[model samples]
Target: MSGQVRNTTKIVFIGAGSAAFGVSFFQDLFATDELAGSTLTLVDTDPAALDRMAGLARVLNAATDRNLVIEHTTDRRAALDGAGFVINSVAIDRNRLWQLDFEIPKKHGVRHTLGENGGPGGLFFTLRTLPLIFDFARDVAELCPDALFINFSNPESRIVLALAKHTDVKVLGLCHGIFLARWFVCQILGRAEAEVEVAGAGLNHFQWLTHVREAATGRDLYPELRTREKAHDPAFTPLTRRLFHSFGLWPTCSDDHMGEYLPYGWEGGEHGFDFAGDDKNREYLKTLIDDVASGAKPVPDDWLKPSWGERAVAVIGGVLHNRHRYIESGIVCNRGAIPNLPPDLAVEVPLLVDAGGVHPVSLGPLPDAIAKLLHVQASVQQLAVEAAVHASKEIALQALLIDPVITSTDAAVALLDELWEINRPFIRPCV
Candidate 1:
């Protein structure tokens, strides 16, 4: 495998309205020499968003002096044709509907730490989004059968697993959970961006770093991280401080965001962000829409810069340059990838990706407790995918019930009912 273009690759971004992510990914794609001749298709329902993304792509292409051919479309099928890779990043207008996901759950006396993942909100999101994903998958099967599908949406592992079990499309899920793991280690060690050694493996947003050591001394940093939280700044929450003390494990996500997923983190006045705070999420969405509609704001410097999303770039680079790079990706259905989990399940693990193709490394079985927790979440994801494929409201309800954040059966049922009612217009009925 040498750095040579064996074939022209077509990469499609499913939701180009997500300019922040699109810009980041496109910049990374443009930076790599292997991706220079690839065709990038930006697909979005919103014409304005697609236009904005086109502007960004042009700026990036000019800056990098890359010959990456850029295309934009609102039709999924048109954008998907002959694509070698597809990346999904769509969200169902959270500002307008996410409040319904949160409010209805709270009405039933169910609390969620974050509405986006691991709760009723996430379930509803899955319900709404999975149908679209399956629609894309079906099209990919028919039109781009040999292409690799990469999901960048939330509940990534579940989504990928659902697709793998239900469709023939080659799929992988990806997230920045590892970046958060690095941030957690840095916070614990009180170091200002020191080089460190770390190893993490597990489901998205739930992976734990089993090893954290100083790069210089090879000294284990976990023990010191365990003890020092007590003396650290009071800005950190007690739930987080205690989690570090008890689990002897620092979580990949922050306390404010992580609290919603775990039961004990938010019980009895525990310090955490309110689950109903859709203010920021809504504001960001509004800003994006407004900027696109009015063209009144200046693009941020960050938007003009490049990013390091490794998967797409690595694949393109490998295919183009024949440079084999190891990337941690959530690939579906490798028998030995994770020892204890069902071989059919999609597992997030490190894989050696190069010009030849993607390969998953077997991390062996996860610890029993972690595997148990992941199994629960994975079940919800699987069920959600099934619901989308079959259009079964019952399966969607079951997925919500299986969710760890929704403890009470009655609450789960109620939230499910509300979501069904709210999302009835968007969801295709299960046959």
Candidate 2:
């Protein structure tokens, strides 16, 4: 492995203040000798968070026995110069802003179990962040023309699509959706640890596994999963239990988080589902900010754990060793990835990743039932990206009205108006 190493690559992480993900990705990057002399730049607007991450990077670099050049910057453009790969992990102010994302929708009669994935909340977030992402894309075009942009931000597919449609930068969206799906498979199999083969493709947060098989044998795993659900295991999380009961299909994401993405989960008044009054998003953001600001070690339980974010590591490994590994990733453009969807829409699918770059596999067309749901969410993502690039409130409103959670035109309009007013300071002006 050491002798198979190739040229070092410059990896720049935007929003390095995000401790949980930043630390995990950095550690994963440092683990391989292939990246021994690589340049690692951490960029963030928050000085306190940057400083803490810088310190953590130093310790990890030394511990890994790698001569990695770790640097920190408050300015994103400065950090991106001459980089080969750029990872975006940014979020708006954690607690206060996220609370608004979750709470304001409730006032407008829109319910969202997960505030950040897909809903009025997710749409508003994309509206505010897309402009900033495109700004970075423009800079990358000028400074790092050949860089591979990996976006880990919320509204993942929308952001990637914005870059693909509006900019020339080579971009791929990264999320832990597949990893969560694997976790569910593991739980359902009743094995402490089991290797399962799964394939899924769709827009972010809406991805569905088409097949689940046991790696050791050629046997299908879906039947076993269905049986486990029938037995009613209390160990299954609330969301999974509810999904099995209602949808007759187990979901890949947690119950609370999956609610915002699916039309049935939050809308159907069954299994005691409550989208409003869920403070987990707020608490998670607060915990993250405090963790990074106070130099808090090992993120709190309230925050998302980063153990499952393996794309960065996988990317680096593939590049360094010229080894191909298949992982499901959210990327812009259909291009035969999902046969049933439009060729231009962004879809998250399994890809063959290597030094050559990511190539998404075609899952053919999704079942019409799933495609309809995906189409609704994908439209919102497309419109939000358009709104950001053009700075058009009308496009943003279009995105809101098309969102699954907002049922009526009046409800959609009211929610859009409130979001527009509340987020005015953050939204970029329409040109």
Candidate 1 residue-wise lDDT, 261-297, digit = tens: 5665455232223434555664575566456435566
Worst 10 residues of 2 by lDDT: 267-276
Q: Candidate 1: which stretches are off by over 4 Å?
A: 1-8, 192-194, 216-219, 234-241, 265-305, 308-311, 329-334, 429-431
Clashing pairs in 2: 239-255, 339-364, 340-365
lDDT (Cα, tens digit) per residue for candidate 2, span 1-431: 56764578788999988866775686566666767788989999989778877776776666567898989999888888899889888877644666677777777777667577677777878878877787788889899998888888877877877777767888888887777877777776875434777777777766777777888886888888878766756655666566556544455556656667766556432223233443565346446555644556553332233245467767656755677877656566777778777777888888777878777877778777777767777777777777776778788778777777777788778777877787777788422
Give the TM-score of each candidate.
0.85, 0.86
The Cα local distance difference test for each model comes to 0.69, 0.72
Which stretches in model 2 have alpha-carbon errors above 4 Å? Answer: 1-5, 234-250, 267-306, 429-431
Q: Which residue pairs collide in model 1, if any? A: 3-321, 113-260, 339-364, 391-430
Which candidate wins on TM-score? 2
